[model samples]
Target: MKTDVEKASVAMRELFAATPLQLNEHLSAKYGAQIYLKREDLTPVRSYKIRGAFNFFRKVIASGGSGKTFVCASAGNHAQGFAFVCKHFSVPGVVFMPVTTPQQKIDKTRMFGGEFITIRLIGDIFDQCYAAARDYVEANDGYMVPPFDHADIIEGQATVAAEIAEQLPEGVVPDLVVLPVGGGGLSAGVTGYFRDVLDERAFVFAEPCGAPSLKTSIATGEIVTLPKVDNFVDGAAVARIGDLNFAALKHFAADQVLLLPENAICQTMIEMLNVEGVVLEPAGALSIATLDQLDPQALRDKTVVCVVSGGNFDFERLPDVKERAMRYAGLKKYFILRLPQRPGALRDFLNLLGPDDDIARFEYLKKSARNFGSILIGIETRDRSSFPELLARFEAAGLGFEDITENEILANLII
Candidate 1:
């Protein structure tokens, strides 16, 4: 019998063409290493999740499991993928998503599934929403299509690796393969396929800093759930790695995984859009973002492949992405200023700014004190060093100012 992954690879061609593996000259020159991006972002559902979803649906129908209703819980890419497959197969599906999910994703999922899928907005978090989906499956005798846990899903995702094997030039093997880990299906599938066919190939796993489930699990030699996950990288901010996926990835050393800060990931997204004209969602940029953490000397002249996971980014979040990127690069900051209640106070502060410095935000918090007022100021500058120079001027002028850029609570409230 043929391997499941081999069968899935043949089956996927019916849905869409294989995504490209393009060499990136810009990144290659910058890193002094050859870099190729596996553009899973260009999939029919704008994500690799569709591969697994389609395979799951196909296997179920082939095994005489047709006519069963399908159910899943997802706030982003997975839902869209599932919806697309549901419509393709002419099967009914129900997707449970958190109420807090962005309307853009919900609309996209709806568009994909059309009349074939029903979307239920339930609960405020994924856990609660997932529980509701599970209940529905049990109550209605529906088939639950899990995001990343099932063997069929893993086999389908491995098709990506199978394509890579065929697409690359004959007799060429990458020195390093980088994958972004959320629930770990993609990483596990790709790594398993490679480990079976190749010898001495290296793998790097990237995870959101806010949800380091894969890194933590690899370190502990078991699965570990994060107490809280920052959903900024919503596409890959899974709190826990799937059990089967963890078992597949457990042998890798902890050092092989890189935990990427949300802000840094934002910077990578911005860089790719601006420099390469590539649109990537936060999770899609994870592998590329981790490249900065690699040792330049070690990676020099090496062949590397970075999986560009998805492009399901909502344009509505562009401003937030830019803000986070600016803050991470230290080119923008917020300050709480205590200004003397005098006529020349504003003029004096204005003179302190450099030629390249621009005021992006200015607001008075309160004027209750007769002698002073609290002001919130946001400044953007040409470079990170400009901030230190501005702060020095503040010190020399005896101005009372507190850098609130790093204060998450206050920044969220005012900036």
Candidate 2:
């Protein structure tokens, strides 16, 4: 662990130096808490993943492990970080990514590794890619570099904590530390180091609401696999937490684990982008989103550190991000309305809408009906309260409608 930390610190110097420990005034004022962001997003790979990857390789090479053949399975930041490490160490790495992985991620991974790495798109999901990577590693007798769930990886991730400790004002320990959990390497590493070095600080673990592996593990006293997961917050949506990480995190209170709704996280992402000009992946925003749930009075004047996990967000996803943010903030909604089949029916319904309401989408589900037709309407409003007023108007006018915004089954098929 000591060696890995030392090597990670050294490797970081060779890259673009240290990521900034930036004080974010926008968040500080909003929460009434002194907030600072550990900008892992500014890392060379736009994530802290490189720290762990470099440490893993450095330790292996120092231990006489062959640098010629290394294997890993990741389609996201991990692959890019591993590729960067391979190039830095002059090692040959075979990276397996899911076939459905985005082209942007694939290109970034390749660009980081250059000629030192070979990427293979294996299967549709990460599990399949992981299995394929294991097979290759076993067959070729190559070293398997796990994305997380390894001592070296955890040790390398601890460097973030070390840096934070060093960067803070003298004799100051943050009141709270917020971390986003995927496989939990970063959280485990940071928490482990703090427990050993610092006096006391509350730790809050954030996970995607769709995939609360750490929260579930803490609740059940064992790691449980989620049967299904929403991949919207793809970065931190792990089905299960790492065994080692679970052990370290299991002692925490269940309430300490904050499950952030994927849509709600979008607001934080957009806020950071627009206000701070900071691009954050969904997982990166989890820590910031958790601040909303805290008591403003309790947090006032207290120093808080939130880890901004990664910034590998693809610009192509901007539309979806904006949509989710609006929906979560209640500024946008979708409804299935049974429109009366009358000449003046459309005019009447249109008149009922409030001044703040705008028809974002108006589509006929089926126009063949004579009595009534199902219309899928998406409404955007300047104020969220406008929805209730509009609903009241619809009620007085005897309009039949169903809010399909939160209906998963219907949304899956229609929205």
Candidate 3:
């Protein structure tokens, strides 16, 4: 009998060609290791989610469960994948997404599914939308196709690992595999598959720092739900790991998972876009961002594979991504400056700026003050070191200012 992963792999070929496993020379050179990327971003729906969705639908049909309509709740890649599969199989599907989901994703899902699927926008967050979807599924006698948390989904996602195993040169096994963990479907599938096939291999999992569900769960030895999660890395900003997925991943140590800051992930996305012309969504860049956290000596001379999970990035978010990257790199800053109400006050402040410093934004917050006016200023510089020099000049000139670059509340309000 064929293993479930093998069967899923075979079944996947009917839907689309296997995503490429290509050696990335740039990453290899940077880390002094042979770096390979399992490019799940190249899938028909631009993510590995399709593998699980297809498998779920396939099994449902094969078991004479096709009479029921398939339902799912997602605002990201999973929705697109499920829609694509629905169209492919001519099965009816209902997708419930949060009202705040990007219009690009909504349009893409509609385009992929066409007449086979109906999209419902409800609620403000995933949890609320998910509850609505479940209610619909229960009331309508429909099948709830979970984005993760199911055995069939895990088995389907394992097809990615199956392809990796076959695509590598004969007898060549990767020394390390890095996976991005959201609700843990891809990580569970890939890790579980490797444990059975490879005798010795190291695994590193990456999760967004804002949503460290998997990392926190592994640390506490139990499933812990986060009260709040930042949705910047929308694809992998899961507040909790799936129950079945956690069970599969529980054997791994807490140290094996890396929590990546959202801004740093944006840096990785920008790097890939500028250097390799690869457009990766924030979650897709997680595995690559974790590379910076690895000890270079440990990874040196090792064969490493990083899963590029998805490329469904909206170009509309590019500006935000770039802004975050700049802030994370310390190349941009915002401040509130107290300037004297004098004719030469603005000129004196401008003189304090270094040669490489450029004022990106300057606005007078209030002009009512008799002695001094408050000014909101944003600065961009060629080097991070320029900030200290500029600040020193401000101190020497007796200028008063407060740096608000790292102050979330202030930055959000003013910058």
Candidate 4:
């Protein structure tokens, strides 16, 4: 498998060169470790996904390529990769993407393939989209280019491990390899390669809290389908682990995987953007987000590599990403406040806020009664500590308020 991966890596040179493996000083300083970012985000499609697509196409085209069609379903990155490969091969392909996929990804996929591929918007999630693609393939007698889960796809992804091995400084060894998990292809491929070639293998897998298919399946020794998957980390939010993928990863203990909150992942994304000028999609930020969760002693002075999976973030979502980040860091909050229906009442509430507190949103829900009115208020503060001080003042002033920042139903409806 490692040799196959190496061969694929060599063949891939005909497409794009190796993605950079750079030492991230900002993350290294914060984690107290020698941290490096395996920058899969720098590939032609701004993701490592192109490797798998290209390899799959190369082998398939070599065998036969008369009138067969190719089809694939993806959340975003895979679609772009498949599209790029379709254009490279001049083969007719169709890509199915989640309807909820960011417009940037959908547009890029179309641009990459040009006349070679057709983009189809389907279903609400990858699993549903994949089912639709499978049905299409069956009905049309077309070939399916799986985003992950195939032996060829895994072999292609393993080339990342091959590149990492070649790029690391001579005589340097990584104490830990952090992988972001979606459908488990990258993790399985990379880990399988490491296990085969490296004497000492250490890995930490990160997955969205809302989607823990790998962790759940590993624990049960069987694949388990999730009841619900949060699509916030759309790139990594998979409902079920692939059977082939699970088989490659089953040897590892369940606890080796970390379930990261979506908000925390957003926070990491913002930090990387602001502090390092590195833009990352939610799933791309997963590996880096797990740094603070590790034992400080475990990371101190050790070498770590975080695979930055993709950077195809849509800037239009920046405000929402910042909002989630601020809420996670306690620097911003939303609440419903009850105030007397008087001109002076608004002034009184304003006075209760500390100097650092700024009203981000103010809206009056219909006046509940004659004397009292419900005001939906959102506050942004420079410091997290400001919230406690402001809350204390509100309590002393007898201002009744309900914190709705974490209220999913209410927050989604209004804020």
Candidate 5:
């Protein structure tokens, strides 16, 4: 398997060169460790998925399946890779993407595949789209290039492990390797290739808290499908871990997987963009986010490598990202305040705000209420500690308010 991965990596030169595994000084200093980032984002398709797709296509053609039509379902990154491979191999293909997939991904897939592939927008979530793709494959006699699960796909993604092994600084042995998990292809491939060199305990997997398929499955010792999933982390929010991929990962305990919150991941994304000038999608930022969840003492003076899985970030989502980041940092909050329906009431509430407090939103829900009216308010402050003080001031001033920042249903409806 290791030899096959090396050969695949070498043959991959026809597509693109090996992505750099450069040390990240900012993260290294902060974590008190030598933190290296495997920049899979630098690929032509802006992700490591292309490696698997290229290998899958190459093997299919070599096996005398050149006339077959390929089909796949992906929320984003994998579709882009598959599209690129279809264009390169000059094979006809079809891509099925969820209707809710980001417009940036849809555009990129279309651009890369051009006339070689047809994209069908179906359903609103990945599972639904996947079902459609599977049906299409059976109906059309098309080969399915799964986003993860198959041996060829896993072998292709294992190239990342191969590259990291060869690219490490001389005489340096990594203490930990962090990887992001979606469908388990990348994590399975990476760990398989590193089985001889690294202890299984040295590997840590990160999954979105909203989508804990791999973590949940590993805990139950079976492939458990999630009943509901948050689509925020589009690339990594898989419903279930792939069967073959789970076989490779089942030996590890659930503790090996870190469940990251979507909001916290957003904070990491914003920090990376603002501090390091690095752009990453929610899924891509998972490995880096794992640093915050670790014991600092454990990472002290150790060498850690974070696999930055992808960088197909959509700039148009910056505002949403910033909103989530602020909430996660406790610097911004929303509330439904019951304000006295009088001229002096508004003035009183405004006077209660601290010097650093700024009103991001203020909307009266019932303007004509007799004595009290509900107002949806959003407040932003420089310090998170300031919110407690401001809330205290509200109480002392006899103002009635409810914090809706953490109330998903209310915030979604009113704010």
Candidate 6:
């Protein structure tokens, strides 16, 4: 029997040409490595998800399954990919998205599938929507094409690695390959192909710290569900690794996976946008952020390829992106201050600010006494070091304040 990787590559040709493997000079210079980006972000649905969707449907058809109706649960790029594939195969599909999904994403899914698909806004979270889709597919005798987990999906995703291998220059294999992990289909696929075809290339996986499903799974030797996940990086915010994907990835060392903080990812996104003119979604920046964890000297003369997974970023979130980047860089901060109820006290604190310091947010909480009150102050500076001088002035002047910049509870509720 032909291996799963071979089958995926065969199915991909029916959909479209391969995604580009272009050299990115800006990233190469920054990391001091000859870097190339596998531009999966440029896929038809703006994500590699379409590959798996197409493979699943094609396999179903090839197996002589008469089922023309397919169902899937997704709130993001996966839904778009499934919808597009459903249209491509001229098959009917039903997409179940969480009711909380943004209107923009819902509309995009509709546009991609057009008359070939029906959308159902079912539950508050993806888990509920997935359960609902499974129930519907079972009852209606429609095929339930999973966003990830199936053998075919893994196979389809592996085609990315196949293309990378074909696109590289003669006798050139990257020293390291980086991938962003969501449900693990893409990572498993690429890693499988790399190990099977080019055993010498090193592999690294990146997952959002808030949703470190793959890293956690590899560490515990079992797929573990996180109690909570930050959905800021919604594209790859999976709670657990896919069963099929974990099986493929089980052989890898635990240290090969990198967990990146969500805030730090924002910095990568902004840098890519401003420096390279790349508009990557939060999850798309995972692999890029992983580069920071690598030793520059170690990769100085090495060849590296990082998958820029998806660029389906909604520009409206740019303000939040900027805020997160600033917070992560330590150039901005929020503090709860105990201020004396005196006119000269405010003036003294103002004078303490460095030349580059600027007040971003200032609000009075409440007066505790005739001489003291609580204040919420947000400050920004050109450089992160400016905070030290600002804090020193607060100490020397005897001003009481609490830095709430990293306080998740207060930041979530207030900022």
Clashing pairs in 5: none
Question: Which is the winner by TM-score between candidate 3 and candidate 4?
Answer: 3
- The alpha-carbon RMSD values of the candidates against the true structure, listed in the order shown, are 1.5, 1.6, 1.5, 1.7, 1.5, 1.6
Which residue ranges in model 5 land beyond 4 Å of their true spot? 99-102, 367-369
Clash statistics: count for each candidate: 0, 0, 0, 0, 0, 0
lDDT of 6 by residue, 205-232 (tens): 8988889888888889898988888899
**Candidate 2 residue lDDT tens string, 1-415:** 5445655776767765777888888988888878989999989899999988888888799899864599999989999999998998888999999999999999999999999999999899889999999999889999999888998899889889878887888898898999999999999999888885544348988898999999998899899999988899888889989988888778888988988988889999998899988899998899999998777897899999999999999999998899889999999999989988889989999999888899998998896477998999999999999999999988898899999998879877877
Each model's lDDT comes to 0.92, 0.89, 0.92, 0.90, 0.93, 0.88
lDDT of 5 at 78: 91
Q: Candidate 3: which stretches are off by over 4 Å?
A: 197-201
Lowest-sum lDDT 10-residue window in model 6:
192-201
> lDDT per residue, candidate 4, 220-259, as tens digits?
8899999999988978988898889999998898889999
What's the TM for model 5?
Answer: 0.97
Candidate 1 RMSD to the correct structure: 1.5
Runs of candidate 6 with Cα error greater than 4 angstroms are 1-7, 197-201
For lDDT, candidate 2 versus 4, the one ahead is 4
Error of 3 at 198 (Å): 4.5
- Model 4 TM-score on a 0 to 1 scale: 0.96
Measured against the true structure, the TM-scores of the candidates, in listed sequence, are: 0.97, 0.97, 0.97, 0.96, 0.97, 0.96
lDDT of 3 by residue, 1-415 (tens): 1288998899899999999999999999999999999999999999999999999999999999998899999998999999999999999999999999888889999999999999999999888999999999999999999999999999999999999999998988898899999999998898888886654338999999899999999999999999999988888988999999999888799999999989999999999999999999999999999999999999999999999999998898898899889999999999999999989989988888888999999898997589999999999999999999888988999998999999988877776
